[model samples]
Target chain A: MSSRDAILARIRAAVADAPEPPPVTRDYRTAHVDDDHAAVVDLLAENLADYRARVHRCTEAELPALLARLLTDHGSRSVAVPPGLPTAWLAAAEGAEQHLDDPEQPLTARQLDAIDSVVTGCRIAIAETGTLVLDAGPGQGRRALTLVPDHHVCVVGSADQVVASLPQAVPLLDATRPLTWISGPSATSDIELDRVEGVHGPRTLEVVLVG
Target chain B: MSGTYLGMPAFPQAAKAATRDTRLRANLRHATHTIRDKRARAVGELDDWAVLREAGKRIKDRTLRHLDTYLLQLEEHVTAAGGTVHWAADAAEANRIVADLVQATGETEVVKVKSMATQEIGLNEALAAEGITAYETDLAELIVQLGDDLPSHILVPAIHRNRGEIRDIFAEKMARWGRPAPEGLTDRPADLAEAARLHLREKFLRAKVGVSGANFMIAETGTLVVVESEGNGRMCLTLPETLISVVGIEKVLPTWQDLEVFLQLLPRSSTAERMNPYTTMWTGTSEGDGPRDFHLVLLDNGRTDTLADEVGRQVLRCIRCSACLNVCPVYERAGGHAYGSPYPGPIGAVLTPQLRGTTSAVDASLPFASSLCGACYEVCPVAIDIPEVLVHLREQVAGQPGHRAERAAMQAATWLFEHPAALAAAERAASATRALHPRRLPLGPAKAWTETRDLPQLPAESFRSWWQHHHTEPPTPPEPTS
Candidate 1:
C-alpha cells in the first residue's frame, strides 16, 4: 500500500477504541470590549498605537492629504500603489513616484524594496486586538507588496471595516483568499525576548482610519 | 534525527553541566520569568479564558478522533486546489521527498520559515547532505544556525544567548552566509534585528524554493496557516516560485472556523499579544499571488504511536505556544539543550520520549527530568495535563529493560514497609551505623544522586522504639464526647 493509505489505516486502528470527543462549548465572549461602535473604533486606535503602529484618524476628504503628508514626513521617494487604490490618495504627494501593482507585470521584490513605501486599503480591522486583515482584495495587493516594502501606510474604513474582536472578524473574511493579518510592524522578540520592530516586513506601519 | 543531538548524554548527565553554568541559568531564569508574568496578565485580561482553553482542547480532540477522515479530506482538497500531497511514515522518507522536490526544481538553495516539524525531522541536515543549502530566516533561528547551536526554546531558539552574544555571533558569522554584519554592530536588540533583516532580504528575493511548516492545516478547505511575527514567513510563503510545507498530521484543524478558537489562544498564550504581528493563511495555490507550485508533506513520524496510548494522546493537541516552557521550573534551570531535542521543557519531557521511544538512554531519562510541579499544566493553552502524562511515561520507561536494579530496590522497600518489625529493625540498624555513614555515596546510582546533593543524617533511634519507651502499656481511652 502507499504510505498515505498505510498511514490512514494506522490512524484508524489507533483510534478504533477511542470514545467520541466531547462537544465543544464556546461560551466565551465574542467581543471582549464594549458594544458601542464608537468605543470599538476608539479601542482599535488605542490598541494599534500601543503596538507602536502610528494610528491616524481622518475623514474621506482628509485621507488624501494625510497620506501625502505621511509620505512627506517619512520622506518616501516613491510609493507602491495597488491596482484598485483610489488615485486621489496620492494626489497631494507630488514629489513621490507611484508604482501600480499589475497582475501581468508585477513589481519584483527588489523593485518593491527600492520603493519607499506601500499604501493599501485593508479588508477589515479587529478592534480588540488592533489587527488589520488584508485579503489581497481590491486595494490590498498580493502578499509581497506589503511585505517587501520598508514602510506601509494602510487605509482602513472606520465605519464599515472595524470589528470588535477576532470572532467577529473571522466570519467577515473569505478563507479561500490569501489573508495577511498585521497587528503591528514586522517585529521580533528573538533577541533576549525584547521586542524590536522593523524586521523583514515593513519597518513602519502607518494606519489611516477614514470614516 | 540530526547529528546535533547524536551522542548526547541522558537528561541528568546533560543537566549536570547546564545547571553549573550560572550564566545559562540566569538567561533562562530571566527569559522564562518575563514571559511567564506577561502570559499571566494576557490570560487574565480575558474573562472566559477557561472556556476558550476547553474549546481549543475539544476542537483538537474531535479532529484527532477522526484524523483518518480529516487527513484524507485534506489530501483531496489540497490536490483540488492546485497542490500535490505526499505522505511519509518517518523522518527519512520525509527528508527524501523534500530533497527530491527541491532537486526537481533545480534550485540549489532554499529559504526556510522556522518550522518545528522540519526541525524535528532534521530537514536542514538532510538538505545539506544532498548539497542543498537551507537558510533559516527567523532571527533567533538565524542566531542558532550562525552560532552552530541547537534551538533552546521553541519560540525563541536563541533564548540562551544574551544580546551581547547575539551581536558577536552576527558580527562574526554573517559574512560566512551571505551579507556581513555592519562594521561594529552593537548589542542592542534593534541593531541585531536590523542586521538580520539586511542579511536575509537578499536571500528572500533571490530564492526560488521556500520550505515551511504550518501552524495549522484546515482540512475542510485545504488551507494552510503560518502564524509569525517577522515578514520572513511572508517572504518565504509568497515570493518563492515553489513552496514546500512539511506539517505533522496532528496540526490539522477540521475547518477554517476552528481557527477562531486557536487564533485567540495561541497569540495570547505565546507572545502575550492580543494577536501576532502577522498570520498568513492560504488555500493551496492562487493565481497571480503566492507560490505557483506547492507541495504538502503529511508526516506521521511516531504520531500514530503516540495516538495509540489513550493517556498520551492528549499531547497531540499542543499548539506549540511555549507557555508550558515559560512556567516550568525544571526548564527554567536545566535550559533547553539539556532536553537534547528541538522540543524542550515540560512538553519535551512528555513528547520526546513518546516520539522517539524510551529505548535510548537520553529518551529514557526525559520522563524523569520534570519535578511534576504541575506549573506546566496550569499555563498550557490546551490544558494538557502534562504532569499526568509525565507520570504515565515514567511508568512506561521504568517498565522497560535495564531498570531491574531500581525496580528491585523499589520492590525490596515495599516488602520491608509491609512488615513493621523488619522496617523497625532496619531503621534501628541504620541509626546504629549513623556515625560511620558518609555524607555522599562514592559509587553506583546512589552516588550519582548524591554527587550534587548531601545524604540526610540518620536519626538517633527509630520513632517506633521511642514511642514504645514513652508508653510501655496501651493508654486508657478518654471519654467520648457526643
Candidate 2:
C-alpha cells in the first residue's frame, strides 16, 4: 500500500474506539470595543500606535498631501504603487518616483528592496489586535511588494474597513484569496527575548486611517 | 562545530550538568520569567479566554478523531488547487521525498522557514547528506545553526544564549555561510537583528526552492497558514520558485473558520503578542503571485502510535504554543537541551517519550524530569493536563524491565504496608538505627537522590507506639441523630 493509504488506515484503526468530541463553545466576545463605529475606529488607532506603527487620522481630501508629506519626510526617492491604487492618492507626491506593480513583469525582491517605500490599501483592520489584512485585492498588490520594502504606508478606510475583533474580521475575508495579516512591522524577540523590529520585512509601518 | 543530538546522556545525567551551569540557569530564569509575565498580561486582556481555549481544544480534538477523513479531504483539495501532496510514514521516507523534490528543481540550496516537524525528522542533516544546503531563515534558528547547537526552546530556539553570545556567533561564524557580520559588531538586540537581515537577504532572493512547515492546514480550502514575527517565513514562502511544506498530519483543521480560535490562542500563548507581525495564508500555487510549484508532505513519524492510546491522545492536540515551557519551574531550571529532542519543557516531558517510545534511556527518563507542579496544565491553551500524562508515562517506563532495584524497593514497601505488624517492626528498627544512618548515602543508585537533598532524620519512637503508650482510652462511638 502507498504511505497515504497505510497512514490513513492506521489513523482509522487508532480512532476506531474513540468517543465523539464535544461541541465547540464559541461564547467568546466578538467585539472587545463598544458597538459604536467611532469608538471601534478609535480603538484601532490606539492599538496600532501601541505596537509602534505610526498611526494617522485624516479626511479623504487630505490623503494625497499626507502621502506626499510622508514620502518626502521619509526621504523616499521611489515608491511602489499597486496597479489598482487610486492615481489621485499620489498626485501630490512629486518628489518620489512611482513604480507600479505590473502583472506581466513583476518586480524582483532586489528591485523592491531598492525602492524606498511601498503604499497600499488594506482589506480590513481589526481593532482588538491592531492588525491589517491585505488580500492582494484591488489597490493591494502581491505579498512581496509590501514585504520587501523598508517603509510601508497602508491606507485604511475607517468607515467601512474597520472591525472590532478577530471574530468580526474572519467572516469578512475570502479564504480563497491570499491573505497577509500584519499587526506591526516585522520584528524578532529571538535575541535574549527582547523585541527588535525591522528584520527581513518593512522596517517602518505607517497606517493612514482615512475618514 | 557539529549540530547533532546523537549519543546524548539520559535526562537525569544531562540535567545534573545543566543545573551546575550557573550561567545557563540564570539565562533561562530571565528569559522564561519575562515571557511568562507578559503572557499572563496578554491572556488577561481577554475576558473570555477560557471559552476561546475550550473552543480551540475541542476543534483540535474533533479534527483528530476524524483525521482519516480530513487527511483525504486535504489531499483532494490541495491537488485540485494545483499542488502535489505526498505522505510519509516515517523520517526516512519524508527525508527522501524532500531530497528528491529539491533534486527535481535542480537547486543545490534552499531557504527554510523554521519548522518543528522538519527538525523532529532531522531534515537539514538529511539534506546535507544528499549534498544540498538548507539555510535556516528565522533569526533564532539562524543563531542555533551558526553556533552548531541544538535548539534549546521552541518559539525561541536559542533562548539559552544571551545577546553577547548571539553577537559572537554571528561575528565569528557568519562568513562561513554567506555574508560576514559588520565590522565591530555589538551585542545590542537591534544590531544583531540588522546583521542577520544583511546576511540572509541575499539567500532569500537567490534561492530557487523553499522549505516550510505550516501552523495550520485548512482541509476545506486547502490553505496553509504560516504565523511568524519576522518576514523570513514570508521570504521563504513567497520568493522561491518552488515551495515545499513538510507538516504533521495533526496540523490539519476542518475549515478556515477553525483558525479563528487557534490564531487567538497561539500568539498570546507563545509570543505574548496581541497578534504576531505577519500571518500569511495561501491555498496552493498562485500564478504571478508566489511560488508556482507547491508540494505538501504529510508526516506521520510517530503520531499514529501516539494516537492509538486513549488517555495519551490529547497530546496530539498541542498547538506548539510553548506557553507551558515558560510557566514550568523544572524547565526554567533544567533548560531545554536536557530534554534531548527538538521539543522541550512540559510538553517535551510528555511528548518525547510517547513519540519515540520509552525504549531509550533518554526517552524513559523524560517522564520523571518534571516536578508535576500542574502549572503546565493551568497555562496550556488546550488544557492538556500534562501532569496526568506524565504519571501515565511513568507507569509505562516502570513496567519495563531495566529498573530491577526500583521495582524491588517498591514491592518491599508495598508488602510492609500491607502487614501492620511488619510495618511497626520496620519503623522501630529504622528509628533504633537512626544514629548509625549517614547524612548522605555512600553507595548505589540511592546516593544519586541524596546528592543534593538531605535525608530526613528519623524520630526516636514510632508514632503508633507513642500513641499506644500515651492514649490508652478507646475511641468513642458517634450517636446517630437522623
Candidate 3:
C-alpha cells in the first residue's frame, strides 16, 4: 500500500476500540456582549487601541476632511487606494498624489512598497477581538494592498459592518475570498519578550470608525 | 526527530547541566513569568472560559475520533479548490517531497513561517543538503537562524536570547546573510525589530517559493489559517508565487464553524493577546491574490501511531499555544533545550516520547521529567491532562528492560508483605541494627533520590509490638450520629 493507504489504515485501527465520540457541544456564548451596535463599536475601538492601533472617529460627511488631516499630519506624499473605493473620501487631500489601483493593471508589490500609506474599507469589524476583516471586496483591493505599505487607514463604514465576536463574523465570511484579519499594526514580542509595535506590515494602523 | 536533538543524553543528565547554568534559568524564569501573568489576565476577561476550553477539547476529540474520514474530506476539498495535496508517512518523506517541489520551481531559496511540523522534519537542514537555503522570516526564528541555534520555545523560539545578544548577532552576522545591520544597532527591542525588518524585507520581496505550516485546516472549506504576531507570516503567505504548507494530519477541523472556539482560545492562550497582529486565511489559490500555486502536504510523522494508544492520544489536541510551557515549573527551570526536541516543556515531555518512541535513553527519560504538577493541564485550553499522560508513559517506560533492579526490589517487598513471619523478622532485624543505618544511602539505584533528604530513624520496636504492649484491640468505633 502507498503511504496514504497505510496511514489511513493506521488511523482506523487506532480508534477502532474507542466508541464514536458524541456530537460537539457549543454551549459557549455567541457574543460576549449584548447586540448593541454602538457598544460593540466602542469595544472595537477600545480593543484596537489596546493593541496600539490609532483610533479615529468621524461622521460620513466629515470623512474627507478627516482623511486629509490624517494623511497630511503623517506627512504622506502618496497614498494607495484600493479599486472601487469612494473617490470622495480622498477629495480633500489634493496635495498628496493618489495611486488608484486598477484591478486590470494592478500595482506590483514593489510599487506598493514605495507608497506612503493605504486606505480601504473593511468587510467586517470584530468587536470582541478588535479585528478588521478584509476580503478583497470593492473597497478592499487585494491582500497586498494593506500589507506592503507602511501605514493603513481602514474605514469601518457603519454599524452594519460591525459584529460582536468571531462566531458572529465567521458565518458571514466567504471562505473562497482571500481574507486578511488585521488586529493592529505589525508588532513583535520576540526581543526579550517585550512587545514593540511596527515590524513588516503597516507600522501605523489608523481605523476610522464612521457612523 | 531532527538532527538537532540527535544522540542527546537522557533527561536527568541534560537537565543536570541545564539547571546549573544560572543565566539560562534566569532567562527562562523571566520570559515564562511575564507570559504567565499576561495569559491569566487575558483569559480572566472571558466569563465563559471553562465552557470555551471544554468546547475546544470536544471539537478536537470529535475530529480525532473520525480522523480518517475528515482527512479524506480535507484532501478532496483542497484539490477541488485548485490546490494539490500530498501525503507523507514520515519526516524524511515529507522533506523529500518539499525539496523536490522547491527544485521543480527552479528556485534556490524559499522563505518560511515558523512551524513545529517543519522543525520536527528538519526541513532547512534537509533542503541545505539538497543545495537550497531556506530563510526563516519570523523575528524569533530569524534570531535563531542567525545565531546558528535551535528553537528553545515554541512561540518565542529564541526566548533564551536577550536583546544584547541579539544586537551582537545582527551586528556580526547580518552582513553575511544579506543586508548588514545599521551602524550602532542598540539593544532596544524596537531597534532590534526594525533591524530585522530591514534585513528580511529583501528576501520576502524576491522569494518565489514559500513554505509554511497552518495552525488550523478547515476540512469542509479547505481554508488554512496562519496565526502570528509579526507580518513575516503575511509576507511569506502572500508574496511567493508557489506556496507549500506541510501540516500534521491531526490539525484538521470538521467544519468552518469549529474555528470560533479555537480562534477565541488560541490568541489569549499563546501570546496573551486578544488577537495577534495578523491572521491570514486562504482557501487554495486565489485568481489574483496571494500565491497562484498552492500545495498542501498532509504529514503523518508518528501521529498515526500516537493515536493508537488510548491514554497517549490526547496530545494530538494540542494547538501549539505554548501556554503549558509558560506554566510548567520544570520547563521554567530546565529550559527548552533540555527537552531535546523542537517541542519543549510539558507538551514536549508527553509528545516527544510518543512521536519519537521511548526506546532511546533520552526519549525514555522524558516521561519522568515532570514533577507531576498539574499546572499544564490547568492552563491548557483544550484541557489535556498532561500529568496523567506523564504518569502513563512512566508506567510504560518502567515496564521495559534496564529497570530490573527496581522490579526486583518491588518483588522482594511484595513477597515480604505477604508473609507475616518474614515481615516481623525483617522489622526486628531493622530495629536491632538502627544505630548502623546511614543518614543517606552511599550508593544505589536510589542514591540520587535519597541524597536530597534524610531517611527516617528506625524505631526500637515495631508498631505491632507497641500495639501488643498497650493491649490495643482495634480502637472502639465512634458512635454514629442519630
Top candidate, metric DockQ: 1
**How many angstroms is residue B469 displaced in model 3 relative to the true structure, after the best TM-score fit?**
14
Q: In model 1, which runs have C-alpha deviations exceeding 4 angstroms?
A: B1-3, B421-439, B452-482
The residue-by-residue lDDT of candidate 3 on B1-482, one tens digit each, is 13387888877677777787888888888889999999999999899999999999999999999999999999998999999999999999999999999999999999999999999999999999999999999999998898888898999999988888899999999999999999999999999999999999989889999999999999999999999988999999999999999999999999999988999999999999999999999999998888989999999999998999899999999999999999998888788888989999999999999999999988888988888879999999999999999999988987999866557777899999899899989998999999999988887756643454479999989997777888757778899999
Off by over 4 Å in 2: B419-440, B450-482
Considering only chain B, report the TM-score of each candidate against the true chain B. Answer: 0.93, 0.93, 0.89
Per-residue CA lDDT of candidate 1, range B1-482, in tens?
A: 23498778888788878888899999989888888888888889899899999999999999999999899889989999999999999999999999999999999999999999999999999999999999999999999999998999999999999998899999999999999999989998898899999999899989999999999999989999999998899999999999999999999999777888999999999998888999999998999998999999999999999999999999999999999999888888889999988999999999988899998888998988888989888889999999999989988877989977567778899999899989988988999999999998898876765664578877887788899998998998999999
Task: Please estimate how well model 3 matches the true structure, expressed as its whole-model Cα lDDT.
Answer: 0.92
For model 3, the stretches where C-alpha displacement exceeds 4 angstroms are B1-3, B405-482
Look at candidate 1 and give me any clashing residue pairs: none
Score candidate 1 by lDDT: 0.91
Each prediction's RMSD over C-alphas, in Å, is 2.6, 2.6, 3.4
DockQ-derived CAPRI band for the predicted complex in model 1:
high
Question: Which is the better candidate, 1 or 3, if ranked by TM-score?
Answer: 1
- Which docking band does candidate 3 fall into? high
Give the alpha-carbon lDDT of every model. 0.91, 0.92, 0.92
